[model samples]
Target chain A: MAELSKTDQVEDLHLVNLTKRFGEVAAVDDLTLTIPAGSFFALLGASGCGKTTTLRMVAGLEDPTSGSIRIGDKDVTRLRAFKRPVNTVFQSYALFPHLDIFENVAFGLRRRGVKNIKPIVEAMLELVELGHLARRKPTQLSGGQQQRVAVARALINKPDVLLLDEPLGALDLKLRRQMQIELKRIQTEVGTTFVHVTHDQEEAMTMADTIAVMNAGRIEQMGSPAEIYELPRTVFVANFLGQSNLIEGRVSGAGEMLDVAAHERSFRLPRERSSATGASIILGVRPEKMTVLDAPDAARVPEGHNVLSGRVTDVSYTGVSTQYLVQASWGQELVVFEQNLIVGDRCEVGDEVVVHWSPRHSFGLDGNEDIHAGVDSAVLALESVDSAPAAGDGE
Target chain B: MAPVLPSAAVAPPSTVAQRRSRTGYVLLFPGMTWLAVFFAIPFVTLFVTSLQTPVPGKSGRYQLGLEFGNYATALAEYWPAFVRSFAYAGIATLLALIIGYPLAYFIAFRSGRWRGLMLVLVIAPSFASFLLRTYAWKTILADESPVTSFFNALHLLPDGRILNTSIAVIAGLTYNFLPFMVLPLYAALERIDPRLIEAANDLYASPVTAFRKITWPLSMPGVVAGTLLTFIPAAGDYINAELLGSTKDRMVGNAIQTNFIEFRDYPTASALSFALMAAILILVFTYIRRAGTEDLV
Candidate 1:
């Protein structure tokens, strides 16, 4: 183990082409990432997408089949979990039930043969705002309180990096959101690199400085939250982060101005966002970016806009916004989210409407890729598991 | 969120609930009565027997009275047997714990699909008669047995004779009660979440330290239960001492048995039995207190 003094400074966590194989299945395959010191990075993926497996590999809980892990200048690939300068806030909290909150937080320090850790643990508890409950056992606290203690327990060790494996998974929705904010605050205050693995897209977007979207044991995209949301490069990334309306089109013009013809309509694309000139592509647009208009007022669309006339198949009022499913006359249904400022202009199902958006609001993806490739694996897995019983009942 | 309602409106419902609770007590009556008859009645008889006055010249004749001096006589005459009984039981329990803890840990965590088979193997010995098993140990530890001969040749045994000794009695006790120790330990260790151990490792505790700070402490409930299971029976046991031990190794159970069946000294036997029970109870209470596991039961 490297001397503790040498590891005092913040160190970047690096995973170099790590691969973990369980039997014939690869859980995490050739995953390489460098999380800069003091950055909150998220590995976002649905269940079985290798996000948790990657985090466990970095935490030294799981041994990679090949490749190395480094913290700062030290190679800790073969190091025992205890010898590494890292800690994790487990999803179950995993707090020592036999110990009080103070002792649970002080456990790591005491294990390293450090005495007089009372003040350090007390300060950490205060940072997590759990100082008042120091004397209570973990079982006595609420789930959220215990979660904070798990965080404090890891943070008090002052490791080079902190790994959180879906730390808010067990909490209720409200508590999860509150703790998301709390986690960000603690990360900022401690200035420790945090590698948070979660399937919640909103959580990743809200808390992470950078997020790597993983799928099928590989990273689909890695970028800032806004960058990932604004310009998803793959069908998976475009669909996984949020709802994206994809319209198949072929690039008809290239150079300073690009044009795409799809569904018997010509749409202009921004020059800077042009892909292969002659290739078929899928134009992507956010639900909120598409505006819905009454079909009778189709001429209201501006000249430089991409427009499609359709009938409203579904209209869902959701407080701040109303979602409209507009089925274009030529084919395909597109989702549009309109602000609910004018309640009097609400459109019912089967109402004729026109959906239009500016050229800049859209991005393009390879038309060859499966449009539903990035749908949540959790939902897909549940469907398969439910299929057996459903088939039995049918028989 | 709902406000408190008037007690008058709640009284009718609570009256029916109270009647249901009475039915629950009625359902419990048969089992409670059976315990009172079979267990409580015998205990009272035993307590009275412990205080009986034995007729000076009549064999097996005792008059019920406050003859507390019988307890003094039993203690004064058989103090060594009482002490030896506890020492043997304590040593056997300790040995069982030492051997069973790792066995249980392996069966619980490392056995994988073999866990069921391993558990069956641990419990398989209890299928046979305990007396038959103790006699089997007698043959194994005999001077001419291969095990004893091997030990003699290896100089592990100073003398080739082990059949009629304290070591043989303790060995018999340990062997007989091993499953009792292993099962409870396995149950407790199995219930522990593996993540707690991994979390300990992530927090910079070495495997040994993790065991000490997490695994061992969490397994205390099982340790307490297993030790009590092994020790309580081993303390009252006479078959092992009679089958494998000499007169010098005779325990309190053997003395009580001899007094009751051979000497016909019912008062003395009852006194010795009561003393053993009282001692075990006190020791167990002190132990549970010291181990800080009173809540386990």
Candidate 2:
């Protein structure tokens, strides 16, 4: 039998091949990660993608089917949930209804046998800006106030790792936005390692320093937010985080520079960045990374920039920016986002246009992958937002 | 600037609608009148009868008069019975709570797929005749019964006499009222979000501490409701005492029943009954206030 390696470095929370199976289904498969100490990390995925389950496993609420969990150097795999040095801010805020705000915040200290808790509890309430409502029951507070109370209560324990399971999922859009900033500020001030699990990509991008995009119980990609967005390693990551246009092409050498061809239109693919050369590949570019101009303005295409001629299939005016779906000659609807430089002078549908982007903006992935994986779901989401005016109005 | 609508524009139509809406109150007339006749009228008659006095030196004969002394006599005579009634009921209520809380907790939190089956079993005994079930206990605890003999062999019972004792009466009360205690407790425990308990554990509370701080306090509303449901009925019950207790353990309810039926002393019986109702009301009110769950009722 091989003995498990026990390292001496005790800097972060580590999971070694943690797996949780609910009968025939594996909610969280063999997953391993090392979250650096004092860093704000996020597990991002759609619902049922195992992000929340992974968070629960880390919190010790759910026991692993196999493998171990460690906080710093201590192996806490078999430890009771209450004995772990971690706390959670549940999605529903689960405040103690019978307790007033002050007592609720003091619960942890009191449980740990601290007789003098007034000072700490009061300071925590003040920190959450809820000092005036210390005497109020949880039921009397609004959703946002209760959320802060939940945060304060968990944070008062001074746990080494704080897990937030979609803490702002219950709040309205405006309050959710406000709390995203508040949470980031609090994490920065306290310097506590925060592992936030959320399905909302915008929320994850706005708050986390490092993000692991999870899918089907495994991490599809893990990196800094910019890296995950600008240089995704999987087709799922490219479309899940934000909108991406994956242009199908065949990669080949084109003397002095490498290029990918699709329907006689070629785009640059740097040789050093090419992983699977001489094979069919997919070139990905973010909607905002590309620029659109009238076809007649072909001379405007800068040197060394890739260009494609297409006709605008659809245009959506969203106040800040306009999203255009261009039906390229390569037989794909390439999405392009442009700022509303001239509000009313937007390009109409069916207008001939040329799309151009720098070579560095292109991201390449294996062509034998699901091209339409996350696109339709995003479109359905947008359609729901459009159909329900109140949903969009709240945002 | 919008023009103000005149009151006549809405007043007449609303008045007509209000007239039509009186049918709702009219529909409630029968049930209201039934309660007034059956419940309210009898209560008033009982109050009057309690204030009456028996004709001088004549048995089974009473004259209506404002004789408050009837209450004094009943209280003076049956004070011990009143005390025993409340004591037996209080002990029975406490026992039911101690036993029922864990049963309810198990069913609510851990029964999983068998929850409905467990609840049915809790209520199954109530479907049979209450008297028949209590009679079954009498047979189970008979002097030569296996349970009593086993207890004697184990030396758990010094005398091995459980039948016709205060302990028997209290046991009968607890058994009969156990469902009342368990159901409300189960409801309260089931309504609680399991996540709250998880949150408690996450906040550094051991399982015991979580139960003490969260489960127990949150389930107080159920305790208050269950205790009242069990205690109030158990206080006024006479069947258990008559079947399982001797004269020494007779409660106020037995005295009232004996006075009204066998002795034909209506005035004293009515007085004793009124006293029991008043005492229970006061106790319930004080308890609810002290428990700080006044809003539950």
Candidate 3:
């Protein structure tokens, strides 16, 4: 670990008004971002979202069509990839097939003409916990092991920032989970800035301290994982991060709390949570945030909670929870996830029910945007419902 | 109630395994039989003929007797031809590699949409007969041809002539076998993952270093295959020398052909062929061993 700390001062990566165009299509539009030093940051998006394009610009692999990039005080906009103090863990791991693990890890050090390479290489192999397999070629190692070698190779250079482009995209689900924690632990131990690019929301939430949600070559939102998840600013972020029940409404009152009316039902939205200034708005609530109770037990609902009466149209029993699709009186179906704590008094399909949640859990967005802007049609087709948990519960 | 079949009616697993192995051998019958009949029999006959002695006072006739002295006499009398053949072939192989590697690399990496057209061009010369192509070169390098006059003006040719020399023969050999070198080199260079080069560059390697470290090592299989394909055929070839070189520039193949066809010395011809085959085999074995492409070969 001591040998790995070659950089004394961590430098923030600054990408200012960066743009890249392939023919007529702008792969990365005019975008500006500042990733803080020594933070585990993630660029979360679906395929073709330009997350990888942004990372390649930072790594100096793709020249920006315009604008400049900087590391702290020095501008690196025109610097060649080899001249820049940046390295990337490519999506395919891209380990040299001819070089064994030891040589692969030693490549950077040797290229820089470091005299004492053997010890440094040995130390790097040990850092990745791959010392025993130093003599083995890349093809001989498993997927996860090759991933660690890729990390070790990039990290040994002591780069100012480490760019990972879908580093865990090739692994199985179980191995991906294991490597997620492993990568987080390594980032913590080395204290190097990690900018991970991935399409998996859960992976971003699990490993990254800050998550930037990207869509169609633009940044929709950037914040801590929890902040972005709980208070998404755009419709794309809300749907892409996880499932959100968006209800179209009109603002009836404005105050510390905004009263929104939707289909003859009034719901309270905290004024701080609403980003829309117009009378028309879209109120969003996560499926797991709302509770579904039978009509007879409606009295037990919290007093100050926003309530909507509906009929349970579909019921799905997952291992940890039961998902109920309740069709509101307005004919819009809302999803509610209830923990399976009580087995005997469960509401069945076709039962009259009331879905309610606190005002704090509701978010407001502009009604001008498309309601299905970020909903993946393929996933929606598979579920036959508007909002089901896109992935496993992160809480 | 259905009746159960007896256990004796079932085939044993070991018998089934044996039948599967038998099928494998049966599948190999045609290829093995063809090699044994055409290749193995001729090779054995050639080796036996190399050791036969000439019949007393009989022209172009041999007796079935052990005459190991034939090998000694062949090596002593025609050692210069053996040396010249190897030297010319070695130079031609080296020249082909130097000329073909860059063409292959460009087609593999930088040609982009024109890759298909370029590869077709590399193989297009092979569509014409090799002998015709060599004859075309003879015309191109004739004493009064434009190419020879151009080189003469540059004073690059000290002898003031391009035809009937070692250079002409070597150039012919290199030109005839260039596609062999280019195709294999292109295949190997094309198979390399571009990301490996990018990774090297990302790790602070300059483009030259990346090629030296990543590109070169990965293309070893192609280089080994290309050199072998070029060198082996060029070594035993007599057509280029016979067409483009003088009497003093003749190779072992010419000597063997002359001994058999003109002088009707069957024993000496067989001995010379055997000696050349053994020499090429040793050179190739040593080359493969040194190149360290054991797994590839």
Candidate 4:
């Protein structure tokens, strides 16, 4: 812990108009972002979305085709990876196969000519709860233990910024969850800026203090996890972060509360929540925000709630919440998630239902963009865990 | 009924296991027979021959009596040749490693699409007969050739000649066994994950430091395998010395060949051959132990 406190000066990481191109294709297009000092920030995106590339550029592993990177007042765009004040926990862990866990953790210190390294390495290993396994080679340890060693290897260096490129991608679901919490705890203890790159929305939301959603090498939205999830500015962000029911609508009026017309019915969207200035818009609402009521219970619906009538096309009775796909009169399907609190009031498939949510829960985006922009990629990201190449970022 | 059922299941699996083991023995029969006939019997014959004493005053004739003194006399007389053989082979192996490692590293990490062509080129020289290749070097390093003339102009050749010298024999040995050095090194180096090197670099290691810390250690298997492949055969090879070297550079292989073919000293030749094998085995065992590559090899 004393060794971790050596980095007393906290510095923000800034990527100013960074671009990396592989021949004709721009892997990371003109991107600019500022990660605040000492925050657990996440670059959330699907595979090949340039999130890993951005992390590598910050780590100085990959040189930017254009633009500069800065840590506090120092511009480090031309610095070599070893010379930079940054270290990366690679996606594959990439632990030194020949070195045991202790030597692996002490590698950076030894390279920098640190005279006394045993106590620092021991403390770092203890922080990762891997002190007993310090004598083991990377292959001798299980996946989770090796992952923590990878973290300790990078963390002991105490760089101004620690870049994580899908560091937990190789773990199984349960281990991934556990490591996410473990990594967050370590990051909090060290108080170093941790920029995590991942494609899992839940992992990003659970661990990161701020999230920047990347799409095709650009930041689509950057905010706190809740801010991006609740008020996504683009169709890609709206669909990529989580499932959203986007209804094509027209903004007939505007003010503190803007009026929208869709499927021959009027709906209200809070003015500040809308990112669209034109008449054409896409109204987005989270599935969990909408309440699914049987057609018979429509009379019990509260006032000031936007209502739509549909028949339940699908009902998935998951333990915590029942997800319902409601096909509206316009033939567009909208999903609604209802908590499984009242078991007898469940809406079976094919039941006629009314979906209602308050105007505060809905956000509006430009209608011109593709409504399914990030939908397929989000599903693909979920299905293909760790399928992305560990070495080649954004390839 | 429960005991009977468990025994019945155990009985079938045990029978199956016996049958599998029997099949394995049957499958191993051909290989065992081949080794016994080709390797084991010849080795036993050689060992017996090494102990035979020559009939007094009769050239190429030997008695069936055990004469372990043949080994003592062989080592006593030709110990210089043995030393020369090991030194020349050691030097050649070292030179090949120095030249082959960077080539192998390039082929594995940096050559990209050209790696296949480079590997083919490494083995291409072996397509010709090894004797022909050694003879080609003799011509290349002859007194009137460009190589000799160039070295003579630079005063690099001590005796104003490149052929009929220890340098020529060592060079020939190095050239002939280089592919053996390169191929194993290439395999081991190529199998290393590139990310490990990048990880080293990211952890504040310069490129050179990364190579020392990560690349060199990981490729130790290749180094051990390549050096053994080059050194072992080079030590016992007579072709290079016969063609490129003079009497002063004669190695143990030359002594064994002359004792067997020309001098008709079967006991001495057999003794020399067995001694060479024993020496190589000891050296390679110690080397493997020192390199700590039991698991890797």
Off by over 4 Å in 1: A1-8, A271-278, A341-348, A376-395, B1-17, B295-297
In model 3 chain B, the worst 10-residue window by lDDT is: B1-10
| Model 4 chain A: lowest-lDDT 10 consecutive positions | A386-395
Winner by DockQ: 4
lDDT of 2 by residue, A88-109 (tens): 9998888888889998888888
Candidate 1: give the clashing pairs: none
Better of 1 and 4 by TM-score: 4
Question: True-contact fraction for model 3?
Answer: 0.80
List DockQ, one per candidate, in order: 0.54, 0.59, 0.60, 0.61
Q: A196-286, model 1: which lDDT tens digit per residue?
A: 9888788898999999999978999899999989888888888888888988888767566677888788887776654433478888899
Which parts of model 3 are misplaced by more than 4 Å?
A252-254, A296-301, A341-343, A377-395, B1-13, B295-297
Tens-digit per-residue lDDT, A1-395, candidate 3: 56876467889989899899999999888889999999999998877889998999888888999988999999999999999999999988999988889999999999999898888888888877899999998877888888999999999888999999988777766777888998998898778899999887888999999999988888999999999999989888888888899999998674799999888889999999998879889999999999998898999999899999999999999989999999998899998998888858789899999899999999999988888877893253223322332222121
TM-score of each: 0.92, 0.91, 0.94, 0.95
Cα miss at A332, model 2 (Å)?
Answer: 1.6
lDDT by residue for model 4 over A1-395, one digit each (tens)?
67766468889988999999999999999998999999999999998999888888888889999999999999999999999989889888998988889999999999999988999999899988888988888777877788888899998888999989888887777677788888888888888999999888889999999999999989999999989998999999999888999999899774699999998999999999999978999999999999988899999788889999999999898898998999998999888888888847688889998999999999999989999999988998887665533322210
Q: Against the true structure, whose TM-score is highest?
A: 4
Between prediction 2 and prediction 3, the one with superior DockQ is 3
Local accuracy by lDDT, each model: 0.87, 0.86, 0.90, 0.91
In model 1, how large is the Cα lDDT of residue A362?
81
Model 3: pairs clashing at backbone N, Cα or C within 3 Å: none
Ranking the candidates on TM-score from highest down gives 4, 3, 1, 2
